[model samples]
Target: MLVSLFDQERSFTRGVDPMVLVSPSIDEEMRRKRVEEENRENNSVPLVEEEKCRLQTEILGVKCSLLRMERDIAVMRIERRVEMERTLKFIVQTYLLSLFD
Candidate 1:
């Protein structure tokens, strides 16, 4: 039975829906589009996750390199202090010897 498109009791599935009956081809097209959209989203999720993992790994590597650089800097400071002390001691001994002469 043909019913008005605005009828509330019309079921779209049973051809009694309020909306005009959609052609089967249009329905198939809509279904296909929905599936394609879902597939694209599903496919992209793994790529996004992989990108996140790669970025995290790169960040960790940078942190490790920075830590190593800081450690090296600390070691260099200690070495410089030791060298300065040795140099000061040598200069004092030279001054003492010259005074005796």
Candidate 2:
């Protein structure tokens, strides 16, 4: 009978083997391995969350810095335009004076 074969601590390859037919020692080992793997996966979840938060914070910081740079560049362009206009006016005045002389 199936019970007798299992009771004798023998492995049968004839059909699908239930968990009971497998040795309790092997079953326990498998259960321990599964528990350890689950624990490892669970422990890594927090680390993944922490990394995500850090990356988001870093991205925000970079965006703020870029905005500041853009504003500074706009100010510099306005200043250069003013300087060029003044120089052009001076050149025109000098040319008119020379023509009259």
Candidate 3:
């Protein structure tokens, strides 16, 4: 049912005309816009690239910090489990000794 509805919508939408879509006037306008965009990009590419590099480096640093935090948490969990086991063993041993006495 959803597929049929989507098909209906697709049919209702205007299909592209090959000739008009690729007309000379349209092509010229597109070319002009593209050239303008390229000029702007040429001006800003270095700055944009520099910012992107900095952001990527910061992201890597954050990821490294997160990994270290995760490792620290894992180590703490292991230490906590060991401590609990030791405490439980001591309690059981004391209880057994009392029973014997």
Candidate 4:
């Protein structure tokens, strides 16, 4: 009974799937969409390159700033060491003077 019903349905539909009829047009449309996407990518390539250059420049600027900050930190550290040594020396000299007195 199910086989008979399936045969009747197949006869009603003429045994042709709808996709089989429209597959060529679907394939052409897919190809056209791909070409459009490729064209879009090609057009945006220059913008991508410009953005890359801009980012590179920003990176260079950041690196320079980092180097400058590192130098400043080194100078500050040296100054701090000198100040600490002077303070220690001053304390030592005061203690020595009181001992002599």
Clashes of each: 5, 0, 0, 0
Model 3 score (lDDT): 0.87
**Model 1 Cα lDDT, one tens digit per residue, 1-101:** 33544454544456553445545687899999999999999999999999999999999999999999999999999999999999999999999999999
User: Using Cα atoms with residue i matched to residue i, what is each candidate's TM-score against the true structure?
Assistant: 0.64, 0.56, 0.54, 0.52
For candidate 4, write residues 25-91 as lDDT tens digits.
7789999999999999998999999999999999999999999999999999999999999999999
The models' CA-based lDDT, in order, is 0.86, 0.88, 0.87, 0.87
Tens-place lDDT digits, model 3, residues 5-89: 5666676646853221223687899999999999998989999999999999999999999999999999999999999999999
Best by TM-score: 1
- Model 1 clash pairs? 5-18, 10-16, 10-17, 11-16, 11-17
- Of candidate 1, the 10-residue stretch with the lowest lDDT total is 1-10
Q: How many backbone collisions does model 2 have?
A: 0
The local lDDT score (0 to 100) that residue 31 gets in candidate 2 is 94
Lowest summed-lDDT stretch of 10 residues in model 4?
15-24
The ten-residue window of minimal lDDT in model 2 covers 14-23
State, as a TM-score between 0 and 1, how close model 1 is to the true structure: 0.64
Query: Which ten-residue region of model 3 has the weakest summed lDDT?
Result: 15-24
Q: Give the runs in model 3 whose Cα sits over 4 Å from its true position.
A: 1-40
Candidate 4, superposed: residue stretches over 4 Å from native: 1-43
